[model samples]
Target: MCRQIHPNLAKDSVGLGGRSKETINRKWDELAICLNTHESGATKNGQCWRRVSLCYILLFILLSSLIDNFYNCAESYFSL
Candidate 1:
């Protein structure tokens, strides 16, 4: 990721800090909470459960591809 995440994760994760990344995250969380207090559990996406899960699934696919590409490049580099 853009920032380092915990290397070892299990079924759940908890952000370890008193504050958020910045003001942007704060505002995003606020909007999400205002929109769906319990339905979406106030996720950062600010969308309903279905939409939010869709977004994350799409993101996972995209990032997985990117990581694959990075490894391919690294293999080529090492072969040189």
Candidate 2:
């Protein structure tokens, strides 16, 4: 006679598999974007682009502020 598995196990297994697939799919998309694949068709790609752009802009602003501060200090020291 064949024994039946618990119903809860089946449900949990299905949920686990779905989560794994979603994680793998996200990784693949990131790799594709790294390779410069077509990102226009994907909703996730739009969010990725926005996040990347925001990060770059913030970095640029940070570096510019540091440079300005350095220049101001140099000018002040030379004027003294």
Q: Evaluated with TM-score, which candidate comes out highest?
A: 2
List TM-score per model, in order: 0.44, 0.47
What would the per-residue lDDT of candidate 2 be over residues 1-71, giving only the tens digit for each residue?
01323343212233456585555445444544553554555444534654665688789999999999999
The 10 consecutive residues of candidate 1 with the worst lDDT sum are: 4-13
Best by lDDT: 2
Candidate 1 lDDT over residue span 1-80, tens digit each = 22333322212223645543443344444555555555644444533443565578889999999999999999999999
Give RMSD to native, each candidate: 11.0, 15.5
Tell me the whole-model lDDT of each prediction, alpha carbons only: 0.53, 0.56
Q: What is the lDDT of residue 7 in candidate 2?
A: 40
